[model samples]
Target chain A: MQSGEDLNQDFRPETEAGGLTIRLDVFQGPLDLLLHLIKREEVDIWNIPIARITEQYLEYLEIMKELNINVAAEWLVMASTLIFIKSRMLLPREPAPENAEETEDDPRTELVYQLLEHQKFKNAAEMLFTREEVENAVWNRPPDEVLEDGGDVIAVTLFDLLRAFQEVVRRFESQRVMEVAQEEVTIEQKIEDIRKCFLVHDQLQFSSFFTAASSKRYIIVTFLALLELVRLREIWLFQQQVFEEIQVSRIKESA
Target chain B: MQAVMEAIIYVAEEPVKAEQFQEVFPEESPEAIRRALAELLESFNARPGGMWIREVAGGYRMTTRPEHHEQIRAYLKTRPGAKLSMAALETLAVIAYKQPVTLAEILAIRGKKSSSSLQTLLERKLVCILGRKEVVGRPILYGTSREFLIHFGLNSLADLPTLEEFAQMAGDQL
Candidate 1:
């Protein structure tokens, strides 16, 4: 990738011919795309090289146009604005009035301010996205049912198992900087080990089963072994209430 | 009183404010009901339970504890909900931060048309019309809804961290 200063070196004809290969994801808007371009070039946002940025921006739009991407009217408007700004920057500066203390506003001032403001919310959106992801996992009680019948809970949600799995993984990851497990454990071996566990204890806390797992592979194999048992009807997973810890027990043959 | 408050919170589809309870028990003093609510909040929050009373969107409601989010998410995976698109979320963030703003202002900042994104936000009930700007064009003004705060698990608009705070956190993480 060319540095920001290198963008000044003209390659206009070649760029137009090749039409720069660029992947276009849906941008939130023109400012989003402009910020991305600015960051990619590692240019100072305050002192944007209008000509270079405008050329790259237009190239991206041209590629989008070729790919049959529906370039919104707003993008085209921004293209015009960039072109206008570039043209203004090329013109000679107007002489300041003798009595006027304030210097003439840089043509880039409004564009720069808009970019800064838009960038703030772009970051804000990312923050909201993270909050949404975290909050998505937290459940509230569902609206009440008209009638209720007491029954033993038999099905554990995958989330419960995953939470237990995550705890194990997080614990191991925090404890060791480098994981090098000398001994290898197979899924079948883990399954057999679990079966032996059930012989002594009728039920095991889902996470407790992984108390001895030392490596990522061991944890993954054990989790897979548990899933296999569940699929085979050899084991039953249960959660008594929403967000409760899971219990793993034998499926118990019906009389 | 706390028990009744707890039951109401459990059954409510939306967060129930203490003031709303006064309408239900007209004879009860507003302060008394508020005290009961505070007590309910304390007891529920103190318990080591999967769910607890949460104060969000200017009201009280039952929500699963953050610690149990993973387990709750596993159960919810079977029933997937639509997530906001980038444009919609960006629009929402803009509305949330500079609420009671007009479409023209939003467009000026985003440097793009966001009417479609605004439509999605309106349809989702995350944003609502605050009224017209009363300017030359009388453009419709938009603001974040109570549902927005509740959806984001915020107590109020004040609960939203400043953009600078978010920036600081991002900087620290890097």
Candidate 2:
């Protein structure tokens, strides 16, 4: 049933113009926007009225342009795809042979499939959103409040540790002696020194390694040794919580 | 045995696995520990209390019941990270449903460049690189991480509602 003419009549530009005042960011992508358009139009997903939809989709892009929203490339690509499909569907199909075995190919087939697939995940995303909403309400004991300043559950990355190290270095530089002195600190020697320290204590603050250093070279060497130990899995470096001191724990054999 | 198991689970910093319980009680068989865990789970569920013993990421953890969420929300000063963006959620849904998927496959389904959303998911530790696909370009394959299951309070990936179920739910909503 080709309701193309009826849908074309139904596509009122003025009414639709006001309808699209909502933000462009509401759509996750082109498919999401198309699905929204299809749902709003109450059209069959399998047999989308492409001419009407392409017009509406372009209108949306135009609105986004007017609103000064950066329309992603994917939206433009889908626009062309809709135009191509609309043109293909408008063209008359060649007559098939009496004994033709192959099914008729519709240009919209690929798009319909993509839309259906995206819709499935969209629905899945909604389901996940609901679950997340419910789960967010249920608090785990000890709360696992990662955003807390001293919460030990939050993980710290190599970048955070490096930033902390930079701060330590900056402080040392600010309070350093004016005299330049060469230091004899090797990475291997520093690594051995760290290993010996771990043998006595289960854990040590990261800054503890640099406290005895007399020169910047010694601190740099110690940092390198720490990295080497980490690479070797001989020691573990981690913050107990966000914005807290990083602790270097010995990697016991059992762990 | 149930009380002992509950205490161990309560004291755990993270979800305590059945294997961990078995490791803790070396003399007990795996089946015995599993039975005790099942019993403990049932006992907690049977009571109309504030606490729920949930199985998340294949491990047990204690969490306040959702019914008391509004009260808890009012009492607590800080909250968990902000909810994920729609784009990030959609990308995560694709990766969760289709594990070992490449960026190309995800782009095909989403009909969008998912790199940013993928980056967000990776940063949140919800999605992880499974390894590279053995294709021409060897694009990185992605899958949901253990944190993903925990975030949704799921026992495992299998606990996620089926796509068919989602379709039905969507139908009802519409």
Candidate 3:
């Protein structure tokens, strides 16, 4: 493979048979390259001149092969799609039967719309990246200092909360069978049980919430109930440190 | 109340939820506390400072605006060993690429124990547990966090360098 500098040096202004010399770097994927060609030729996206785009697309693929850049399967898939569209376009449009609708929907419309939408997102992403690069070139700040206020507490990330929930589920699952034989329980009942449990104990080790008597169903129901409490602004979950036990408590919503 | 919330954010090392704020203002109704939080959010939003208050993970915290990340990067570059360690990078890569993945899967790819490194990344607010995979073992699934994006100066996961590019770079370094 040629170095970037070597590739630039090898660049020639001489146009190919079709009068197009596409630089690979400007293209993000097969669709992007096709969109550029379509726009450059001023072809209607709804009525794309498939022959021209296909030629250019193939030429780009040839260039990629020449440069030994391994083409991913997605690119190949797009190639076939282009060929299919081109072939469909080549076939003469049969006149609709007298009673049929005046015009059939263009096959290219959906594909073209998708391509345009994708290009728009790609451009937006690129613009954002360029902006980030420029901003990153100038800014500096130290790691956030730990909160010093006596009441300020470190909050857990959603990931941590999810993980803690998962741990609760796992422990509950292991003891599920034994609980299943004991009795049936509903989520509402489980919530009441959990509320009662919390009422008795100031802080329950997250693990203790799921005991051998807890069925998988009961555990899941209980977990959902807890989440509902959190969402309803009735309860809060917290962890003191990494890998430490997560604690849940009734939110004293009212100060 | 505004001062109290700001003071709490300033002092708390971790993201502080509104509920935590309630603990500080125990006498205030949750509704009142929420109203104060809304006011605080508005005040921060109107500010011209580089830092902004953001609700992340389930809490409110102060972080630099995405526009100001380059400044943070430049500042951090001057400090040595502040860069993420290679192990952290690898672990993060696994999480970002194959998100909601389990520790077992991460270890399988890394061919080494990652529990400690994962814990470190979790502590640093880089990676997070998404949930447990509902498979035979129900292993905890991990993924990159929103802070992960903010720290890396990305708006989304798609902003991360492609897996192929990362692999090539890692190969060259190796």
For candidate 1, lDDT tens digit of each residue in A56-130? 889878766766556888889999999999998899878867887442457987887778777677778877777
Off by over 4 Å in 2: A1-23, A97-103, A143-255, B167-174
- In model 2, the Cα lDDT at residue A116 comes to 75
What Cα-based lDDT does every candidate model obtain? Answer: 0.77, 0.80, 0.64
Backbone clash numbers for all candidates listed: 1, 1, 14
Model 2 TM-score is: 0.80
Q: Is candidate 1 or candidate 3 better by lDDT?
A: 1
Query: Which candidate comes out best when scored by TM-score?
Result: 2
lDDT of 3 at A131: 39
lDDT of 3 by residue, A53-98 (tens): 8887787787777765657666787889888878887788787678
Q: Give the residue spans of candidate 3 off by over 4 A.
A: A1-25, A98-105, A123-255, B41-58, B64-174
Measured against the true two-chain complex, the DockQ scores of the candidates, in the order shown, are 0.24, 0.55, 0.05
**Sliding window of 10 residues with minimal summed lDDT for model 1 chain A:** A7-16
* lDDT tens digits by residue: candidate 2, B79-166: 7558998888899999999898999999988888999899888877899899998879889999999999989889898988888886
Per-residue C-alpha lDDT of model 3 across residues B1-174, encoded as one tens digit per residue: 998898777655456777898888889999999999889989987999887776644667666676765566576554222455445565676677778899998765544466876988887777877889999988999988877765555556766567555444423322
